[model samples]
Target: MNQAVPAPTVSPLRPTDTRSTAPTRMPWLSLAILAAMGFILVAAETMPAGLLPVIAADLQTSEGVVGQFISVWALGTVVVTIPALALTRGFRRKPLILTAILGLIVANSVTAMSGDVVTALVSRFFAGAFTGVVWGMLAAYGRRISPPARGGLALSIVSIGAPAGFALGTPLGATLGTAFDWRWAFIGLTLLAIIVFALIAFVVSDAPGQAASARLPLRRVFLLPGVAIVLAVILVWMLAHNTIYTYIAPYLRATGTGIGPDLLLLVYGLASIGGIGITAVLIDRVPRGLLHGSVALFVIAGTVLLLAHSSAPAVIAAAAVWGLTFGGASAQLQSALTLAGREHSDVANSFLPVAFNLAIFAAGILGAVLLQSADGLVLPIVMIALGAVAFTLTIVGRRTAFLPRR
Candidate 1:
């Protein structure tokens, strides 16, 4: 019993154009700017992880306390994203985006100058609150500004920033911390945010917000046919990923493989980039097929990790496979949600960060419990179990949620 929803009304990016305002050309430059925004947000959120020792020493806190920076930020996003989006549904998209980026610049700058852990943690929480706005809008913005047919490609292009952030951003923070001071890492993120701010303001096309009559209630968006299913998949799949990923160093240490976590993450990150490329090429054509294949490959990769814990080469190979499985996940899931929610995509999209952050928080708890009570090998076993659930959900949603383009 799905109600008919109008195709998104593409308002003119500029104020001068008065006729039908849909863009005839692809906004690649704008898409890149949005991608850069994603890049800085993720890098800023994760950079602290790479600078734990230096940050803790400078703030005169323990490394264990500094580690909570990531968790606190995730909690902030979970707390604010949905409510923020619900309240601001009618604001112009570009201003909301710019304001969020500015918030990041301020948050990072504050973190760079803070002398104590309390001040720094407050800044990180605000940074995550801003992230809630930016991430919630990125996919919907990509779709609204692109040709309807090219939405998937635009999403893939924009989403490249996330995996790229994980691959390059964290390492960049580490490099800056090592070369200069840990404060330089936050300063570096602030600099990147400033550059992204200018690019978005001048180059990115602006889109109008939904009219009051057209806006859907947040609860209505939540109950939309495919929205809940997609959110469920994000939760389970990411729970599985973070469970293993958060404890990757411990797990690798147990494996007797001499391979370090940094090297393993690098391999995975590069493979994730490759995965994004593959999705860009094929997502528009075969989303269901591509998703199915990647998830299946992911399950196989988990199996490999389970069986070859002692072989460095096998573990490395499995990391590559896992990276590929994850690289395009943001694009794929966001696209599915958009298709299902149609005109209500913005509210629906906001659920993504909520589900994602909750998964990270849950994974931390789940992984900690297992590590304390059982063997490290149990982490992968949990991954395999959750991945199987994700695979089944995708199968169930094939007709309703992951439907191929006509």
Candidate 2:
């Protein structure tokens, strides 16, 4: 029997801080704040998706056209993430994060007040660009502050905020949209952003030695074969998940399942939270290969939903499984990517979010086209195709000598 050797642990403090009487470090609070920032930024981005119909009615445009707003946001994020991460390589974390929060505030405010569809789309674009910066900075910050042995767990905690945002934001936005207007959803997000911004500004410190490195080695970071494989895995998974998620409520309604939008949103949000919670505990203990294998369960869940269209209980169970696997697999992939780019974790982390948003953009376009075709089976088929791609990638990744050994 081969016993697993744990990764070496680092104290979450500077070496020069040699005060023998110093209190034990508390990194978890800082991690929580970083996670909260992620949650708010993601919520701000995804809130619109749940309120798409309301926004379309308000703007007097078709829902299809309104959906383009999400695409625009993802496109903007992909375009900006690499450059932003590279350029800000040596900047202090506090200012980098603060600037992102400011941009988010402005973006949310603009989106909330938009009088027309074009303006709303532009606001979402700016929001995405700012969100990219935040995502990169937060990941770097999490790595810097965490005890080395627990890096995976720490990063997973911060990453969990994104799915948590999805879980909460969609339901919150739908509920608010139904009560007042979709604009209020943006307003609520703006307030959440403000709160997180203030908390982070007060609690989080500038990452040590960040300013010591003057230039980011972008070329070297991208040169790793594992980086590309990890990115491909992330992209395929997101594409698969979003193709079904973007229309989950609609699909539920179409199947004559009496589930309301509010209840569906609740299920998604709670299931995602459950997934993240489970992963937070299991990631450090589970073998990386087994963790990767578990993502296939999401594919299975999506297929089950497609096949059992007449069973409401089965559909709901599948939804929970889908949410759990999607959320868990995301954290696993991020951890794998960070390990693959250990020398340039920030840049590597930047790619994960960029790839994620780009996949969302692609999925939206492809899902929209599929929905227009009126083929009830197309979405699930696309999901299974994506799942197959993910599984193949996982197998190929396992064969690669570049990945960290179990």
Candidate 3:
């Protein structure tokens, strides 16, 4: 019998090796630092919304015109997310993240220095473009760095940063804008962005090499049946939520509510935090269908407030409920998208922000139009219709379970 040739010994470091030995666990300090970076980035992006009225007054423009700043920022993100993902595919994570942070730094700095509405809008557009890249990379990095079992939790932690930013940034921006000027808010954001840039640059590293075949396939992402339905849910939900949120200050003033803008921001922010916390607990335990059903209750509550706009307390309470449910729905929808495109999680994840921003743009335009139309009655009605759409889609989508069994 011919002697069998001894198999060549394979080096563990070989590119063909499929097994990942284990990623060296970073200290919690590093994780916290990364999370803080995420917080600052998101805060800078959203802080303008809270300061919109102040900016509008200073710039001598209508609130509706000021609202376009938000739409433009979101539109930038909507247009950039996918292309950014593709461009950065082969790039190292650390450098790309650093570049994004730097972009925020520049964007915020420019926004703070802007002398007119046009310059501010341009700065915001650039800020959102960078934000899109940061968000896409952050999600992809979160999944890569985490162990399989902890992936959802890791993403959740990352997701929480955005809402946390929203929660904190709004009140902070409003208070600062009230005390000083709107430009100061952007200045504060610029300083924060610089700090986050330094932290990320110093702490994080590139992810381990992935299998070449494991790269996200856009074709597969589009082919998933649940993608479009889930996108619709996200679009409608965001449109409804932002329709109210975008003009909340004006709405309160119109209703003759004594609650100041700062107070409203505080209430909305806190409610959002509560919602996020509750959803974090329920997402894994409760079925998606039921979780969405529960969120629908808050939408109804919001509708009730719109109808019964007489009581200040009731309206505030409804806003709180809306914040809670809206926050939870956002998280659930993101998780759903991730599950829907298990094979192309990054590509699917990219769509969430894209859909979210696009919806925001649509909502702002429509809300502005409604506000200009017959005595804002159309606003509430449109919100109710959006809530109905969300509820109906959740029910219809529930029948087809596309997500993998946990």
Model 3 stretches astray by more than 4 angstroms:
1-21, 24-27, 208-211, 401-406
Model 2 steric clash total: 1
Which lDDT value does model 3 have at 199?
70
How many clashes (backbone N, Cα, C below 3 Å) per candidate?
0, 1, 0
The number of residue pairs in model 1 that clash at the backbone is 0
RMSD of each: 6.9, 8.9, 5.4
lDDT of 1 at 381: 88
- Stretches of candidate 2 off by over 4 Å are 1-24, 146-153, 208-216, 375-377, 401-406
Candidates 2 and 3 compared by lDDT, better number: 2
**Local accuracy of candidate 3 as per-residue lDDT tens digits, 15-40:** 33444564545334445656676677
Give TM per candidate.
0.85, 0.87, 0.89
**Candidate 1 — which residues are off by over 4 angstroms?**
1-20, 48-67, 113-116, 146-153, 174-182, 372-377, 404-406
Order of quality (lDDT): 1, 2, 3
The alpha-carbon lDDT assigned to residue 89 of candidate 3 equals 62
TM-score of candidate 2 on Cα atoms, chains taken together: 0.87
